[model samples]
Target: AQTVTQSQPEMSVQEAETVTLSCTYDTSENNYYLFWYKQPPSRQMILVIRQEAYKQQNATENRFSVNFQKAAKSFSLKISDSQLGDTAMYFCAFTGRGSTLGRLYFGRGTQLTVWP
Candidate 1:
């Protein structure tokens, strides 16, 4: 089984500010995919960004970016220009092949609040 961990249960940031959410995962597979998903009040899991295990470069999407440290098994999300619309439950997810195929493992999620 793949495991993901989000250390912070809650976080808040002012408008136009920046914030980083920490995440770590444990997996035995060498080839896999890591993702940061944002689920707003609407409860739709939006794919913020993704990183492939074999890639050395981190992934970024517009205002969202990821700090992926393969050796340390760390993948953290950094949100630039925090907006009130960004407030939501952010989840760190993992998917791989073999025994863990066809399943996505998710962290408990960190509730992020963007204050005006």
Candidate 2:
């Protein structure tokens, strides 16, 4: 079975700074997709970033980026210039291509609080 792990359960940051959320996964599937999704206070899950198993370049979106270590199956998210709106519960997810009906496996999540 595949599972995602987020060691840090809670995190905080000051406005206009930076923060990184750590994530790791255990999977035997050779090909898979990893993702970072943010759920704000409203409970809407928004994709922060994603990386294909074969992609070498770390996926980046605006102030968000990921450190993907394929061999170790580690994926961490870095948020630069953090803002109040960036506060949310971040989840690390995985979807293995080996499944006939692809399913999403999510980590427990890390709650981020951005303060002024």
Candidate 3:
């Protein structure tokens, strides 16, 4: 079984500032995918960023980026110039070889608050 851990339960950041959320996981699978998802008050799980285990370079989209350490099994998300919309419950997730199942093992999540 794969396990994802988010050490911080909550994090606060000022708008326009940068905030990094930490996540670590334990898995035996050689091939897999890591993801950071944001769930807002609407109860929708939105994809923030994703990192492929086989890729050496980290993944980034706009202001969102990830620090992926394949060897250490650490994948952290960095939000640059945080915005109010960034306030949400962030989850770290993993999917093994059977991605067709679309089954994801997720972390408890970290509640992020972007204060103005």
Candidate 4:
């Protein structure tokens, strides 16, 4: 079994500013996928970004980026130019490659508030 942890239960950032959410995981599997997901008030889980365990370079998507450290099993999300739309429940998730395929583990999540 794998476990993901979000140290911060909540965080706040001003509009147009930047904020980072921390995450760490424990997994014995070498091949896997790490992801950051956002769930807004609507309760839709949106994929913010993802990182393959084999990739050394971090993954980025527009204003969202990840700082993935494979050795430390850390995957942090940095949201730039934060907007009111960015306020949501952010989750750190993991999925394995082989036998555990299709199974995803998630952290409790961090509530991010973007203030105007």
Tell me the TM-score of each prediction against the true structure. Answer: 0.97, 0.97, 0.95, 0.97
Clash list (residue pairs), candidate 1: none
Task: Give the range where candidate 3 is weakest over 10 consecutive residues by summed lDDT.
Answer: 95-104
Question: How well is each residue in 1-116 modelled by candidate 4, as lDDT tens digits?
Answer: 78899999999999999999999999999999999999999999999999999999999999999999999999999999999999999999999987668998999999999999
What Cα-based lDDT does every candidate model obtain? 0.94, 0.94, 0.94, 0.96
Worst 10 residues of 4 by lDDT: 97-106
Residue-level lDDT of model 2, residues 1-116, one tens digit each, is 88899999999999999999999999888888999999999999999899998889999999999999998889999999999999999999999888613899999999999999
CA deviation > 4 Å runs, candidate 2: none
Candidate 3, 1-116: lDDT as tens digits: 67899999999999999999999999888889999999999999999889999999999999999999998999999999999999999999999886424779999999999999
* CA displacement after TM-score superposition, residue 69 of candidate 4 (Å): 0.5
User: Which whole-number lDDT from 0 to 100 does residue 19 have in model 4?
Assistant: 97
What lDDT score goes with residue 8 in model 3?
99
For model 4, state the Cα shift of residue 77 in Å: 0.2
* Residue 56 alpha-carbon offset, candidate 2, angstroms: 0.7
